[model samples]
Target: MKKLILTVLLSLSGVVAATAQPMCCYNPVLNCIATRTSVRQYAPTAIPDSVTTTLLQAAMCAPSAVNKQPWEFITVTNPEVRNAIKQAIPNSHAAKAPLCIVVCGDMNQALEGQARDFWVQDCSAATQNILLAAHSMGLGGVWCGVYPNTDRCEALCKVLKIPANVIPLNVVCLGYPDPNAPAPTPKDKFKPAKIHVNAW
Candidate 1:
């Protein structure tokens, strides 16, 4: 009810975990993980600050390598800024969402030498936490990669005014799922054959 109808539009448009699933049915955490899906179509209403805070708190709780939590999050709600970022990447929906959280790695805070690559894993874990947290909060989001792609990284750096020491890992596009869009079936990724007993 964004363009067609007026709902109370806040600054952080939020909600839309799963309309099909009953709220009383999930075991909170497990429900979030199991029902989570990548949402592209979103309502334009803004989310509450408290909800955003919860998402960030969950993200920061992620474990890091060598205790080096070198992740940085840039929460974007400005339409112009989001559009600018969208233009920087191919097939990016960052601009479409009501809020775009850009997760970055602070290389300066990362471990030294051979362990430098650990920042990637650390940041990735943080991203996953955000995604799950969003779902749990009844919000929909998708992870848009940025780190490994040189063009994207560089472009984002310029757009976001990121310093030389920080690297944007990915963009978490978030918003309330559009009620009108058809809900797709959630994928079942469990693979018994891939499991190995002690080692592969």
Candidate 2:
């Protein structure tokens, strides 16, 4: 009877320990999600290659329509090239960040109308992944839109020499934070009438 009681207590303690440790550091993930903000200012310090690769890996993990994975990333670390990109993008503060990742969607793999206009959705998901991963890594980043604007797209196309079918979706700037940014408070974006109980 004593041996069985001890075994039961040890098993219970093991279960408790497993649950207490959390599946994957939820607090840090929550901290990343809660404290993440669009960091416009960045320190000139360079980020190590390992960190950059980790962030890209996280971005690539984002889901895509039909598993088409119609996404491409162009990382620009050269100051001269980054400066040129900044000039091409009017009012884009991406140059401040030490690194910039250009997110694009492959038109050839798009389902209909480039995934029936679903390319943006897929690209946006990737961008969000970049942002979240940057935050989680204790780095700051921001997503700056570029594709929809013809002038901006044309300028980038001329500079990068990208093919016509590849669409530039956004430019993600990443670096060590230079400011104490605030998190966005959740707003009531949905109205009560918009809610449907069981039927529309």
For this target, which candidate reaches the highest lDDT against the unseen true structure? 1
Q: Write the per-residue lDDT of candidate 1 for residues 26-87, one digit (tens) a residue.
A: 67766677789999889988988889999999999999998989999999999999999999
Candidate 2 structure lDDT? 0.82
Candidate 2, residues 13-78, lDDT tens digits: the string is 999997865323567776566566778778788999999898889888988898888898898889
- How many clashes in candidate 1? 7
Count the clashes in each prediction: 7, 3
